[model samples]
Target: WSPYKLLTVFTFIFQTASKDGEVRLVGGQSSHEGRVEIYYGGQWGTVCDDNWDISDAKVVCRSLGYSDAVTVLLKAAYGAGSGPIMMDEVACTGNEASLMFCRSNGWRRNDCHHSEDAGVICKPNEDESGSEVEGTTHVLDRSMDFAESLKNLYETRQFCDFNISVKTNGKESETSIICTHRIILLLNVDANFMVKDGAENFTLTVDEECTPYVDDFIRYLYIKKISVTLKSSKCIHKLASMYGILELQEFCSQLFTQLLPEDLSFQNQLSLYSYALSTQDTMLADSCLQYLAWNCKAFAESEAWYQLTWDQLGNFLFRSDIVVPDEFFLLEALESWILKKGPNSPDLDKALIQMIRFPMMHPEQLFQLQFNFTLYKSHQDLFQMKTLEALEFHTVGFQNLNQYVDLSNIDYMPRIYTSPTWSYLLSGSSIYNQYNPYYRYDYQNFYSQLRSYSSSFHTPKHTSFLFQSDMIQWSFAYYESAQSCRNSGRYCYYDNYPVLLLSFESRPSSNYSIQYQNKALMICKDSYVSDIRDFKNNLVVLPSNDTSSYTFPCSSNFSYQYVVRPLYYSEFQNTQ
Candidate 1:
């Protein structure tokens, strides 16, 4: 018989195939070592050394249901000298299936029979059982053990009905069956309970009854209550404001560390920072600023620019005690100065000279002083003087000075001839004429009358008293002319003529009566005069029965000689 046949029979008798179809280790061995003969195709052979490591031994041990390999031996460690050795010297690394298939260095050709073989045995350790009793039920607590058991049961989806039996002097005293999905073993006292296959030996007693556990429901209720409270509280605004500026910055830092762009705008960033500042929360503002300073280049630039601008403007506004209104005026003046003096002007002193020479001159003339005292505090004297000097020689004509003058009077024309109301009226008239040209004659007559001096024309005694009655008449005429031109869809041609009238007759307390040709046309206050043309003879009477009448200047040769009647307190109130 062949040596392989003899070895095969021996292996079959010693190691039966496990359910996994592998020869399992049988007794006393913790690892596989020493080449053991294997039977292959009715021949005995040795496995040679090839690729091998502890991992191979591990596979071998686990194949037999042994936990793991503890050791591995290479070469012939068992014995030496044998027959054809089936295959010379036996060499098997721990990784190979058996001694027969391993590669050999002519060692398999040697005639060593009993020496070249591999073997292994089953050797069990306490750890292999996967359990250890750490304490007894008498003096040791079982809470930790029970907790672990509960975790295991929960993970495995096991339903548990624990029956507790209290024994006194080796006799059952009390019994209770508690059904649960999982039990939390608490510390303290002694208790015993029965489970599915084994009675659990518990040493700790649970004083409180187990409550139903619904993780999702509990979490939902908690979150809903918190959300409702937050929604109802006014403090939420402050809290949210705090977090938007403070927490968001911190979160962005860690989240977008590498993705932030390089060329962000400073002005955009200031909007957020300024909001944070306005919240009156110093901590939030400080945090936001710190983050901005660290992460955004634009923020740093904006902060620096703001500091410089504030230092320059703040000194003038606060230190000089310039009133808030004048500060705005000064800014206007500065804009004008910049336009004329050139933005790159080396010295502001010359620029101020130009500012003071024209626009400032009007205010000066009107107020009879170098500065308008009503516009600024007393402490602003020197600063105002410096500003005036800076603007004097920098601007052109009287334009800058007229900007500061209050021109409600036609007699008080600034050299610039530009007044706020007049500027608006002229612009509107220009637009109106672009669409209508029929009013050219009317405009010419009005300009001639405005330029001419007529002592017979009614003029208010007080320059401040605006003429209301004349304004109403002018308004009625302008509205009619504009309507006619616009209806014709042609150029109005009244480029310099006023298209709207400011009514002084509509004053709250003015008790004027409207009449046509010495006959009452409409009662005055709290009533509407729908159409003035409805009156006969086109004559309107005043509140006094003095037969005083006014005529439409446009009726006679398109005349523009209109009167300026004095305004009463009631007239101003009605307009307002």
Candidate 2:
């Protein structure tokens, strides 16, 4: 029978005969719409259905092994019923029936109750194996094993491949055959089958229930999960490696740059430059040094440089070395740039002053020039006097008289008109007057005698001053006279005195004013002062109309004294 007929047979048996708790078989059909009989209580019966169609008859005929079915009928009772009808008023269409028995709609409507419900039965051709058999027989019985049965079926059917084997009850079962690459018929067996490796297992099933496709679906899931995992791990590793390398480079570069500037300060720029030039990885160091040079030069010319001393430079350089090379180079470059900008710039002068003290050949000339200017301004008069004294006292050292003296310029000799010695002489005995005579003197003879005496003596060429014991003693003896002359009056009379005097007048007291007397003192805190010679006693306070001025004496020991009188005023007012 066709597979559709077999399915109809099973469905009919499950729906009709099985519901009655009996096992019965239905056969002997002719057309697709064939009559079906049921045996109940040892009597054969027919079923009648009013609502019936060719589709219902087809199912009945196919279940009974007929080729096809055409029509179905229904009635109150089966027509010509001589036996007991299991169910009357059977309702069916072409879709009803089973190979076990034709199905009937139980207890349906009836027009005439006296007529027996009857159904027609037809016989198919005797040679047509599609016809139903009379009684129960072993239709599944076969001598061939399961494998042989499956092979025979596959040979008979061009659309099937019986590659699988079935074993039942310790013997091969001839139960079913499967179509290749399509249906997998597992007959009454509970066992897993393995498809060959690399072969695509498309479908998996157990007892006709579809399950997961074996090869492609499972492999796709594994591949997708694994691929994602591998890619994420690789990305994380790559990122970690990149970050670690970058951080290492940054740290190394920082340290390298910091050490470079010190090499420059030590006049080892060439060594540092060569080291950087030789190393392929010294780009950071090179850039740093170049920047340092430029910045430091700029800083040297700025006002901030002037405020910075050598000690401060040492501290800054030491601290900067702790940073990375790149940072160090950038900062050094900025500093060098500042230095090069010059002293008028902020702090540049102070920095240059500190660096100038270092004994380096390149900067020595510049240092000397600056030193010369400062020294000239600080001691210009002393130098001038020394020069004049050297020329006068050492005239005889020159053998050439014309080169040593200009006799024609007699008026050039300093006259005694403003001399303190002359003033003293005028106030003293008359013998000083004859010795001084007039302002006129024989400068030619004096210059000739001085030259002759100096020519007879010998001294070092660089030594401009002649040291004499008598001259020293005489200068020391007149020290108190010089000091007295300096403090004698409001205005200083001695130009040679080192000290300068300044005074201010106190205001007169008034009835509206409150007078409180106090004193202010200025103490030298520096260690340089050892005596009054090193001290500035020039700052003085004097009472109005008084000749005497208060002086704060210099002392090595701890001492305090009143230096200035109280500040006095007629009235107090808030200017702010």
Candidate 3:
């Protein structure tokens, strides 16, 4: 019989049968899924779900006119079932025509309570226009016939807006999936049935019955938007992986076009590294990795660095890019990570030490690693070979590159910025600054005034500073002068371009924003460098290194502190 006809037959037997000789679903929202009860001895009784599994749930689903069982729920998913505990320890091969056709401990013989009653949510089959197709919709981990016709509606664009009410924090948010032409090329899932008869809009009212799927559905709508820019790095990564055109798929090219490795914050660089790995954006990933290697000492001590797994920690120690102040930093960080795991922790298996490049290490570093990792004579030759390879690389780079080690299941990482190397020298600017008729410096001079105001300060992460702490509707950045340029002296000159290192006790900001306190007025870059009045149409957001002290103007001693609005890290993710 057809799947639909069989489902109808089960529904018939479940709903009505005078002699009580068939199985039926009860206490559910629909006929095809719910509590499992059988008609036996002129009375309906429930089944106990002892050792129930997919094979058993499959039989239950197919017999009731479903494609297959999605899940096996215990603990009385449809509430306590009354009457005899008809079947126990049921086992099936998923090809059985009925529950009785499968092996079981037999009727009314079970060591189960009413709470252990077996239940199955089955797939609904559709046979529209007499030429139906057969396929299963996987939802909640089950193979079910679900919304095939509606999937067609989404594809055809022959529908109106549909409302889904999502409840959160005891409140409902009405979200809409609008029908439009641009989405025609997208949202293309196959189906024939539709909810609308003419043009009436459909409202999917979600309440207590389906509370679990509310948050998931809301996220689904946001993902469907395929916005050009997204705020969440997680979400943007999700869409890019799923759609291939959303975010990171082409981001490698984007990184090449407009971004340098130095543009991103430690957090953003970390995210971009993972993003690069996933999308095979090798150039970006390599650049980010190089930064971490170069600053091995600082990163090793960072809160984020300690979070790395043994594999990440080991790999960094073994890389050639880790040449900051020399490679001894690798041995120290690796030993630190291992000690944190405890001497007996399996994660510190001595075999992993082989991954470290011994030859590249200075003699002292080799002695250090041996003290930490080596003890067995059986692996002596292997360690010796690795040492030679490291020496070869140190002497003449990699004469022959080996395959990279594998590190799986890593979902996220942290990042940091490298020191600045300027394109021009700023020496000529000092003389110009002294004679420029913008404004005269106070007795504090440039250098002394800067020392009075701590260059480093801390602020909470905000998208925009509303002059208020919470509920910031509009976020922005403003510069406060803790120190003046008169004290900076020669340190202010970089590449002949008037550059200054403005250090405040600041966490790396997400983006750059500077609106004068006058509200919305900004000083453009190089606009009246020494004058206060030139802050009208020109506000310069100096290049950021995304560190405690970011790159800013140093030629003038204008007391400047930048107020920045929080931003989606991805939006400015090293925007090349």
Let me know the TM-score candidate 1 reaches against the reference structure. Answer: 0.17
What would you estimate as the lDDT of candidate 3?
Answer: 0.43
Candidates by TM-score, descending order: 3, 2, 1
Range of the 10 consecutive residues with the lowest summed lDDT in candidate 3: 406-415
Candidate that would win on lDDT = 3
Tell me the lDDT of model 1 at 475. Answer: 22
In order, candidate lDDTs are 0.30, 0.29, 0.43
Cα deviation at 218, candidate 1, in Å, is 17
The regions of model 2 sitting more than 4 angstroms off are 1-35, 39-44, 70-79, 82-84, 88-114, 121-576
Tell me the tens digit of each residue's lDDT in model 1 across 1-576: 332232233322222222211333322322233443434333344432233345555555655456666665544454432322333333435444433233332222221223223443333556544456454333333333433443444344344333333222233333333333313222111111213235454221221121111221112111211221311222232333333432222222222211122224434334434544566644334433433323222332343323323223222222211111122344344443344434443344333332322322323342333354322342255446644542442232233433553223221211111122111121223334444343334644662111111111121221121221332222222333334535545344432122222233333343342211111112112111111211112222121111111110111111221222221122212211
Off by over 4 Å in 1: 1-236, 245-381, 390-576
lDDT (tens digit, per residue) of candidate 2 on 1-576? 443333234322212122221222233233322245555444554544444445545555565566664344444222344333344334444443342233332212122121334343333445544545565533442222333433433345544332332222223333232333212232211111223332333232222111112221222221211121221322222222222332223223333433433332333333334444444334443444443333343333334443433433443343211111122222333335444544353344333233221111112232343344443343355434433433453333222423544422311111111112111111112212323222223656552111000001111111112211111000000111233433333343332222223222222223222222212222222211111111113221111111111111223221111211111122222111
Model 2 TM-score is: 0.19
- Residue 383, candidate 1: how far off, in angstroms? 4.0
